[model samples]
Target: MKRILRLLYYMRRYWWQALASVFLMAAVGLLDAFRVLLVQPIFDHVLHPGSPSQIISLYKIPGTHYQFTLQQFVPHFIHNVWAVVAFTLVVSTLLKSVCDYAGTYLVNYAGFGMITDLRDDLYEAVLRRSLSFFQKHATGTLLSTLINDIERVQYAMSSVLSEFLQQFFTLIFTIGVVVHFGGKLSWALLIFVPVVIGSIRRIGRDVRQTTRRGQDRLAEIQNILHETITGNRIVKAFNMEFWELLRFRDAAKRLFKANLRSVRAQAISSPLMDSIGAIAIALLLLVGRGQIQRGAMTEGAFFGFIVALFKLYDPVRRFATFYNNFQQALGASSTIFTFMDDQDDLVEKHRAFTLKGFQKSIRIEDVGFAYRDDEGEKNVLHNINLEIRCGEVVALVGPSGAGKSTLVNLIPRFFDVTSGRILIDGHDLRDVSTRSLRDQIGKVTQETILFNDTVRNNIAYGQPDVPIQRVQDAARAALAHDFIMRLPEGYDTLIGEKGFRLSGGERQRLAIARALVKDAPILILDEATSALDTESESLVQAALSNLMAGRTVVVIAHRLSTVRRATRIAVMEQGHITAIGSHEELMQQSPIYQKLYQLQFMDVQELPEPVMMGKSGL
Candidate 1:
C-alpha cells in the first residue's frame, strides 16, 4: 500500500492535467447518459407515431407570438421535432468527441512526464550507490531494472491511470442513469458482479506473480549478455560459445513463458467481465418486462434502462483490464524502490579528515584483509605492516597467492583493511574523503583499461580539462607520442575497445602517460610489464623508471630485475609480510624472497641482490 501511495504521490505533481482529463471524461459519461434520456421522446414522437397535437404541444414562432397544436399546425410540429432531434444528437456527438481528445491528450501528457521522471530518477539512484552495491548485484540485473522493468512500468502507466479514471467515472455515471431510469432493475445487477470481480482479481494476482518472474528471467538474459561481452576472449579460448548460446536461449525461453502467462491473465479479464455484464442485462430484461406489463414503467423507460445497463458494462470491463495493467507496474516498482534505497558501501565520514599533503610516511599498522565468498569462506591477508617513505620506490614480491596485490589495494582504500589501519602521512585512510585520498595517488595496472576515446582524451583522462600541450608532454615522457602521432587521426584517433588496436606495450605506455599527466605525488604499478615480451617490457620498464622520479612508488613485482631495482623489497607469504629489506639483505634473511629469485630469474639473467631505495640521508 505504501508503494502504491508513493507512486500516486509522485504522480500528483501532474494532478492538474489528470484532474482536468478526468473531468472531461466525466463530462463524456454524463453526455452518454444524457443520450439515454433522448430515447423516451424519440420513441413517443417518431417510433410510436403519436398524434400531431401530442408531438408538438408547444410551438412558438421565431418572429411572432402564435402557438398552436400539431393538429392545426402540422408543418411546425414536424420541423421542431426533427430539428430538436438532429441538434441534440449533433451536440452530444460533438461533446463526446471533444471530451475524448481532451482526456487523451492530458492523460498521455502526464503519463509520459511521469515515466520520464522515473527513468531519470532510477539512473541517478544507480550512480549514487556505493561499490558494495555493485559487487552484490550483477551488472545485468541492474540493466534489467533500468531497461526492461522501467519500460514495463511505463507501458502500464497509460492504460492503468487513464482507463482507471475514465472507466470508474463512466461506471458510476452509468449506474446513476440506470437508477434514474428504473431503480428496482438496477438492484438486480448486484448478484452477477461479485463472481466476475472475484474471478478477475484471481487472474490479476497470477499475472502479478508471473510478471515478477518474467522480470527475473529478463535479468538473467542481461547477465548472460554482459558476461559474454566482457569475457568474449575467455569464451573463445575455452571454446564455450555454443554452451553460452544455449544458456542464453534457455533464459529467453523462460521469459517468454512467464510473459505468456501474464498475457493470458490480462486477456481473460475483458471477456469474462463482459460475459458477467451480459448476464446481468439479461436478468434486468426478465424482471423489467413484468413492470411494463403492469403499467408501472413506460416502454421507453424499459428501453432506456436496458440501454444504460449495456452501456454501463463497458466501464466495468475496462476496470478489470486496468487492474491487470496495475499489477505489471507494481512488479517493476519494487526494483526501482530497492535501487533508490540501497546503502552505500563507502560513505563520507561524520567528520572527514582534511588531506593537506604527504609529510612523514604512509604507515600500514598490522593490516589484515579477508574477502569472503558467497559460501562465507574467506581469502585472508594477515598481519601485514609497512612504512613507505615519501619519494622512495618500494617493491613487493613473493610466490603466487602471496597477497601482495591485496596489500597495495588496501593502501589506496579500494578495499578497507579487515584489521588495523592504513595511515596517509598520519591521518587514517578511513577518516579522509575518498576522492581526496584517491587524488593523491596514481595507479597503473597490468590491464590498461583505456576507454574508446581519442589519444589526447585518454592521456588527459585524470584531468579532463588539462591543456593539450601538457598532455603531449606527458605522452612524450611515457614514450607514447611517436606512435600516437602515427595514427591516421593523430591525437584525435579513437582507441578501439580496451585499446585493442594498440600493442600491449603501447597501451601500457598510454596508461603511464595518463598517470604522468595527473602528476600525482604517489604512484602504484601493479605488474604493469608482467605480460609484455622482453622488448615491450624493456620499454615499459624504462617508462616506469622515469615515472618513479621524485614520487613515492609502490611496485607489485613479477620480474626479478624489477624487484632488484626497488629501494626495498617486501616478501609476503600466507597473508603476512614475512620479510622486508634490500635485495642483498632479503637474499640473506628471507627464504621466500630467495626462492622467488631462483624460480623467476633462472630463465633470464640472474639478479645479484635487491636494491633498497631511501630518501636522501633518510
Candidate 2:
C-alpha cells in the first residue's frame, strides 16, 4: 500500500486528468446500474401489462428508496411509453460507451506519463551514483530493475487503476440497487462476505510471495543473458560455448519454475471466488423465491435483484484479481525503491571549491588505502609519499601488484585515500570539486577505450563541439591523421564497437589524440605502449612522446626502455616507494632497480646511451 501511494505521488502533476477519469468512470457505473434497473420496467410494462395497477406501478423508479414514478418526472410532451423506454436505453448505452472510452484514455495518459517520469529519474539516479556503487551492484540486475521491473509497475498502474476505479464504482451502485429491491435477501447474502474477504486475502498473500520469487528468478535469467552476450568473445576464445549454454538453460529452468508458481497462485483466485459466489447466489435464490410467492416482493423486482446481485459479484471477483496484481507490482516496486534510496558515500561536499589549474606539483603525503570486500577490508597501500613536479616526466616502475597503478589513481581521486591527504599546488585535493580537479588531468591507459562513433567524434569526444581544424591538428600531433584520412570515409567513418576496426597502434594513437585535444596540464600514461607489436609500439611511443612534452607526466611502465628517458624514476615494491632518483642513480644505488635494469637491459651495448652513461635524455 505504501509503494502504491508513492506511485500515486508521482501522478500529482496529472491530478486533473485523474479526476476527469474518475468522474467519467463514475458516470459509467451509474449508467450500468440504470440499465439493470430497466429490467423491471421492461417486464412489467412492455412485455406483460397484466393489470392497470401493474401499469401504474411500472411507471415508478424501480430501485429508488422513495416510490417516485417516472410519469411524475417526465414532461407531458413525451407521452408514448415504448418511445420513452427505447430512447432512454439507446441514449444510456451510447453515453456509457463515450464515458468508458474517454475514461480509459485519461487514465492511460496519466499512467504512461508517470512511467516516463519514473524511467527518466531512475536513469538519472543510476548515473549520479558513485563508481563504488556500480562496483557493488551487478549491471544485469540494475538493468532488470530499470526496464523489466518498472515495466511490471507500469502494467499494474494502467490495468489496476482503470479496472479498480471503474469496477469499484459499479460495485457500489449495483449493491445499492440490490439492497433497495431485495432488502432481506441482500442482507442474507452479507453473511458470506467475510468468507469471501478471507479467501481473497489469503490467496493475495500467496501470490505476492510467489511473484517476488518469480521476479528475482527472471532477473537471474536476464543477468545470464547479459553476461553471455557481452562475454561472447571470451567464451569463443576458451571454447566454452556449451558451458555457457548449459548455464543459460539452468537459469531459464529456474525462472520457468518460479513463474509457474505465480501462475498457479493467480489462477486459483477466479475459480475459488466463483465457487464462493455460487454458494451465496444459491442461498439468495432460495430465499428470494419465497418472498416473490408470498407477495413480499414483486416478480419483476425479484428478477432485477438477481441481476444486480450478479453484477455486484463481478466487481468483487475483479477486485480479487486486482489485489493479486497489486501485490506483484508491490514486489517490483520494493526492488526499485531500494536502489533509489541508496546514498553514495563519496558524494562531494556542497561548498567544495573548483580547482582552476595545476601549478607547482602534486604532493602525495602519508597516503594509505584499502578495498572493502565480503571478507573484510584489505589494505593495499601503506604510508606513501611522492612529489611530482610540473614540466617533468616521472616514471613509476614496479612488478605486478606493486601499487604503481594505485598510486597514479590517487592523483585523480578516483578512490579517496583511506588515511592521509593529497595536495595539488598546496591546496588539499578533498577541498576541490571532482570535475574541476579532473579537468586538468588526462589519462591514456593500455586498453585504449573508444566509443562506437565516428573517427572525428571519438577524437573530439570530451569537447564535442571542437572545431574540425583543431581535431585535425591534434590527430596530426598524435600521428593519427594519415591513417584516418586513408580510411574509406576519412574522419566521418564509424568505428565499430570499442574501435575494433582499427589496429592496436591506430587505436592507441586515437587515444593519444583524445588526450592531446583535452590538452590538460597533467598526464598519466599507464603502460600505453605495452600491447603493440614492434612497428606499432614505435608509432605509439612517438605519439606518447609528443603528448608528454612539457606536461607534468606520470608513467607506469613495466618496460624499463620506455622509462629510460624520464627526468626521474620512482621504484615501488609492495605498497611503498623503495627508491626515487634518476634512472642511473637508482640503477647504481638500489639493488631492486639494478635487478630490474639488468633483467631487461642485459645487453649493455643495446641500452640507450642516457641510461648506460647517466646522461639527460629529455
Candidate 3:
C-alpha cells in the first residue's frame, strides 16, 4: 500500500490531467449504463406499437425521491416513441465513445509525464552515489534496474492504470443498475464475489514473487552479455568463445524457467475467476426466470437486469488482469526504491568549505584504510604517514599489492580513510567539498581513458570554454600537438572508443595534455609510462616531465630507475611505508630500498649521479 501511494505521488505533478481523465471515465461509465437502460424502453414501447408512451424509470437518485426517465433524456421535438429510443441510443453511444478516447489519451499523458520525471531522478541518484556503491553493484544489474524494470513500470502506469480506472468506474455504474432491478436478489448472487477476489489476490502474490525472480535472472543474462561484449578481445585471445556461449546459455535457461513460473501464476487467475463468474450467472438466470413468471418482475426489466449483470462481470474480469500487472510493477518498483533510498556515506557536511588552492604541504597522519569497513576485511594500508611539500615530487616505490595505488587514491578522497585523517594546506580533506578538492588535483593512469569524442574536446574536457590556442599550447607541452595536426581533421579528428584510433604513446600523450590543460596544483601519476614500449615510454616520460613541472606530485611506480632522481622516494611493503628518503639517503639508511634498487637495476645501466631537472622534472 505504501509503494502504491509512492507511485501516486509521482503522478501528483500531473493531477489536473489525471483528474480530468477520471471525470471523463465516469461519464463514459454512466453513458454505458444508460444504454442498457434503453433496453427496457425498446421492449415496453418501441417493440409493442400499440403500447402507450409510458415513462421508463432509468435511475433513482441516491437518498432522494427523484427518479430519471427516458423522456427527460430524449429531445422535446421527438414525439414518436421509436424515434426517441433511436435518437437516445445513437447519442449515448457516440458520447461514450468520445469520452473513452479522451480519457485514455489524458490518462496516458499524465502517466508518460510521471515516468519521465521518475527516470530522470533515478538516473541522477545513481550518478551521485560514491565509487564504493558502483564497485559493489554490477553495471549490468544497474542497467537492468534503470531500463527493464522501469519499462515494466511504464507499461503499468500508462496502460494498466488507465484500463483499471475505466473498468472500475464502469463496474460502479453497472452495479447500481443491477441493484435497482435485482433488488434483494443482487445481494445473494454477489456472495461469490469475495471468493473470486481472494483467488485473484493469491495468484497476484505468486506472480509478483516469480516476476522478481525472473527479473534477477534477466539481470544475470545482461551481466554476462556486457562482460563478453566489452571484453571480447580478452575472450578471443584466451580462446574461450565456447565457454562464454555456454555461460550465456545457462543464464538464458534460468530466465526461461523463471518466466514460465510467472506465466503459470498469471494463467491460473483468469480461468478461476471465469468459472466463479459463470456459476453466479447460472444462479441469476435460475432466479430471474422465476421472478418473471410470477409477475413480480416485468420481462423487459429482467432482461435489462441480465444485461447489467454481464457488464458488471466484464469489469470484474478486467480487474483480475489489472491486479496481475500491478503486482509486476510493484515487484520492479521494489528494486528501484531500494537503490533510490540508499544514501552515500561520502556526503559533504552542510558547511563544508570549498578549497581554492594548494598553499602548503599535504600531511598524511597515521592513516589506516580498508576497502570494506566491516569486520573480517583486511586493511589495505596501515599506520601510513607521509608529508609532501609544495612543488616537490615524491615517488612511492613498492611491489604489487603493497598499497601504493590505494594510498594515492586516499588523497582525492575516492574512499575515506578507515582511521586518522589527511590534511591539505593545514585543513582536513574531509572538511572540503569533494568537487573543489578534486578540481585542484590532476591524475594520469597507465591505462588511458579517452571518450569517443574529438581530440580537441578530449584535451579541453573539463574546461569546455577554453580557447583553442590554450588547448594547442597544452598539447604541445605534452608532445601531442605534432601528431594531432597530422590527422585528417587535425584537432577535430574523432577518436574512436577509448582513443583506439591512436597508438599507445599517442593516447598517453593526449592524457597528459588533458592534465596539462587542467593545470592543477597537485598531480598523481600511477605507472603512467610502465605499459608502453621503451621508445613510447621515453616520449611519455618526457611528456610526464612537462606535466609534473612546478607541481606537488605524488607518483606510484614499480620501476626504481624512474624515481631515482625524484625529490624523495618512499619505499612501501605490506601496507607500511618502511622508508622515505632521497636516493643516496635511502641507499645508506634503508635496506629494503637498497635491495629493491639492486634487484631492479642489476641487469640495466644505473645513473652515476642524481640528474638535476630544470623547469620540468621526470
Candidate 4:
C-alpha cells in the first residue's frame, strides 16, 4: 500500500485528466447496469406486442412506495414500449461506447504523461549521482532499473489502470442491479465475494514476490551481457567465448525459472476465482427458482438478476488479473524508488558562490582522503599538504599506489577530502559551486576518452557552437591536425567507439586538443603521455608545453624529461609527500628519490645509449 501511494504521487500533475476519466467510466458503468434493467421491459412489454403501452418502472425505492419510471428518463414522445426499449438500447449503448472510448484515451494520456516525467526524473537522478554511487552500482543494474522497470510501471499505469477503473465502476453498478432484483437471494452470491477477494490478494502477493525475483534475475542477465559486449577484446584474447556463453545461459535459465514462478502464481488465480464464481451461480439458480415459483419475483426480473450476477463476476474476474498485474508493477517500482530516494551526498552548499577566476595559489591544507569498500574505509592519502601558485608547473611523481591520481582528482572536486580543505585563491572548494569550480579546470588523462563522433565535434565537445577556427587551432597545437586531415572525412570523420578507428597516439593527441579547446585557468595532466610511443610522446610533450604555457599546471609525471621541466617535483611515498624540491635538490636531499633514480640506471648500463636518452629514470 505504501508503494502504491508513492506511485500515485507521480500522477499528481495529471489529476484533472484522471478525474475526467473516472467520471466517464462511471457513466459507462451506469449505462451497463441500465442495459440489464432494459431486459425486463423487453420481456414484459415489448416482446408481447399485443400488450397495451404503459409506463415502465425502472427502479422501486426500497423502503417506500416511490418508484422511478422510464418516462422520467426518456422523452415524452416515446410512450410506446417498443419505441422506448429501442431508444434506450440504442442511446445507452452508444453513450456507453462513447464514454469507454473517451475515458480510455484520457486515462492513457495521464498515465503516459506521468511515466514520461518519471523516466526523465529518474534519468536526471542517475546522472546527478556522485562518482562513488556509480562505483557501488553496476552499469547493467542501473540500466535495468532505468529502462525495464519503468516499462513495467508504465504498462500498469496506462493499460492496467484504465481497465481497473472500468472494472471497479462496473462492479459497483452491477451490484446495485443485483440487489434490486435478487433482493434476499443476492446474499448467497455476495457471500463468495470475500473468498474471491482473499484468493486474489494471496495470489497477488505471491506474484509480486516472484516478479521481484524475476527482475533481479533479468538484471543479472543484463550485467553478463553488458560485460561480454564491453569486454569482448578481453574475452576473445583469453579464448573465453564458450565460458561466456555458459555464464549467459546460466543467467538466462535463472530468469526463466523466476518468470515461470510468477506465471504459475498468476495463472492459478483465474481458475480459483472461476470455481468460486461457479459455486455462487449454482446456489443463485436454486434460490432464484424458488422465488419465481412463489411469485415473489417475475421471470423477467429473475433472468435479469442472473444476467447482472454474471456481469458482476466479469469485473471480479478481471479484478483478480488487474490486481496481479498491479502487484507486478509494484514489485518493479520498489527497485526504481530505491534509486530515486537516495540523497545526493555531494550536494553543493546552499548559496554557494561560483569561482569567478583562478588567481593566487591553490592550498591543500593537511588534506586526508579515504575510499570506502566492503571492508570499510581504507586511507588513500594522509596529511597531504601542497601549494601551487599561478603560472607554476608543479609535477607529482611517485611509484604506483602512491596516491598521485587520487590527489590530483581531489583538485577538481571529484571526491571531497576526508579531512581538511582545499582552497582555490583563498576560497574553499566546498564553498564554491562544483560546476563553476570544474569549469575553471581542464584535464588530460592517459586513457584519452573520446566519443564516437567527428573529429571537429570531439574537439569542440561541450561547446557545440564553438567556431571551426578554434577547433582547428587547438588541433594544430595538440599536433593532431595533420593526422586528422589524413582521414577520409577530415574533421568530419566518425571515430568509432572510444576512437577505436584511430591509433593510440592519435587518440591521445585528440584528447589534448579537447583540453586545449577548454582553455581553463588550471590544468591537470595525469600521466598524459605515459602510454604513447617515444615519437608520439615527444609530439604530445610539445603540445603539453603549449597547453601548459602561462597556466597553473599540476601534472602526474612518469617520464624523467617531463619531471625535470616542473618548477618543483613532489615525491610521494605511500600516501605522504616525502620530498618537494628541484630534481638536483631531491637527488641530494631524499634517499627514496636517490634510490629510485639509481634503479632506473641500474638496468640501463647494457641497453643502447639512445634508449637511455630522455628516459623517465624514476
* lDDT values for all models: 0.81, 0.85, 0.88, 0.89
When summed lDDT is taken over every stretch of 10 residues in candidate 1, the lowest stretch is 68-77
Which model scores highest in lDDT? 4
If candidate 3 were superposed on the true structure by all CA atoms, what would the RMSD be? 5.8
Candidate 3 stretches with Cα past 4 Å from truth are 61-66, 373-375, 558-561, 598-618
TM-score per candidate, chains pooled: 0.84, 0.89, 0.92, 0.92
- Which of the predicted structures, 1 or 2, would earn the higher TM-score when compared with the native? 2
lDDT of each residue in 1-618, candidate 4, tens digit only: 898888888899999999999999999999998899988778877877765656788888779999998878788877778898889899999999999999999999999999999999999888888888898889889999998999999999999999998889999999989988888888776577678878989999999999999999999999998999989999999999999999999999999999999999999988888888888888889988888999998887998898998999899888889999999999999989899888765779999988888989999999999988999999999999999999899988777899999999899888889999999999999999999999999999868899988999999989999999999999999999999999999999999999999988898889889999999999999865345667987787788888888899999876677778899989898999999999899999989887666654233464445654455673
| Pick by TM-score: 1 or 4, better one | 4
Estimate the TM-score for candidate 1: 0.84
Ten-residue segment with the worst summed lDDT in candidate 4?
A: 600-609
Q: Please say which candidate is ahead in lDDT: 2 or 4.
A: 4
Q: What are the per-residue Cα lDDT tens digits for candidate 3 across 228-266?
A: 988999999999999999999999999999999999999
Which scores higher on TM-score, 2 or 3?
3
CA shift of 406, model 3, Å: 1.2
Off by over 4 Å in 4: 50-54, 62-66, 71-80, 486-490, 528-530, 533-535, 594-618
lDDT of 3 at 97: 94
Worst 10 residues of 3 by lDDT: 601-610
Would you list the clashing residue pairs of candidate 1? 382-575, 567-612, 567-613, 583-610
Predicted candidate 1: what Cα RMSD to the true structure?
7.8
| Candidate 2 backbone clash number | 0
